[model samples]
Target: MSAAAEDEREEQYAFPMPPAGGWTADDLDRIPGLPPHTELIDGGLFFMSPQTDFHMATLRLLEFALVSAAPEDLYVVREMTTKLAKRDRPEPDLMVVPRKARTSREQTWYDPSDIILAVEIISDDSVERDREIKPRKYAGARIPHFWRVEKSNGLPVVYVYELDPATHTYAITGIHHDRLKLAVPFPLDIDLTEI
Candidate 1:
């Protein structure tokens, strides 16, 4: 195709412009042609890049482990946004929420209070957000528990953090490289090598 023709075609498929105050959390559901796992943070929309094999394998391993270990009252979910504020709705790679918090099958997001644990598996494109930004936001929202998984030597390294309610910050609890054995957020004994 000619350069001019391609430019015109691209303009026709351009994403919607943000409203006066940028995009709201609710706007995520209404936006058309948005790629899957789109998030709203501080009134701005963030689109996720395609997943890698490392990201996918780690996510699947954690999700399966969490689901198997979670109590009957807690539910495991993947790629579901958590509503932290009007403009801050982030989709953790995997989340453990209260079974009762699920309002309906159509529910797109969960309240932060309903989430017991939020896990983010680091991806090349999301290193900064997973390592810093999202953890700060989740801690501020007092989500209780957060786990960040990083790929090292072709293996998953899990960094666990517990929210400090008084300071609204996260305190590092443990960093598990091989076996993930945790007492809080339910008893979890996962073999990271499986990923």
Candidate 2:
């Protein structure tokens, strides 16, 4: 392929950037079909690469594990946006919220207070955000739990964090590579290797 053609293709897959001053969460809604794999972060638009097969499998596994352990009144959802502020609406890979709670008449976003857990499956496209920006934001919003799932040497590594009310930050509670056992948000266990 020609160099120019290759460059163009690279640009096509790159994340779209908003004009100066950035874009708000509302601006993202103006697009038709509400295109997937995009998010508004700190008032800016970021496009994410699609998950790999293994990543999707791990996500499904964790979702099932969380759902099976949560109480009947709680809901386990994937890719639902949480309105942290006027400019911030992040859709976690998985989230746990109250079953009866509705964030809006349209049921598009959830109120931050309603979220009990937020999970992000790390990918090459989202390393920084998943490791730093998101946890900081989730903590700032006072979300109770934040879990980061990362692939290290081809295996999924789960890091669990719980919010520290006094500091408004997440403290690492557990890190698991094989079996994941946790008591918070109710007891949960999973064989990570199977996924």
Estimate the overall C-alpha local distance difference test score of candidate 1: 0.91
lDDT per model vs. reference = 0.91, 0.86
TM-score of each: 0.96, 0.86
| TM-score for candidate 2, residues paired by index | 0.86
Which regions of candidate 1 deviate over 4 angstroms? none
Over the stretch 140-192, how does candidate 1's per-residue lDDT look in tens digits? 88899999999899999999999987898999999999899999988879999
Clashing pairs in 1: none
After superposing candidate 2, which stretches have Cα over 4 Å from the reference? 1-21, 103-105
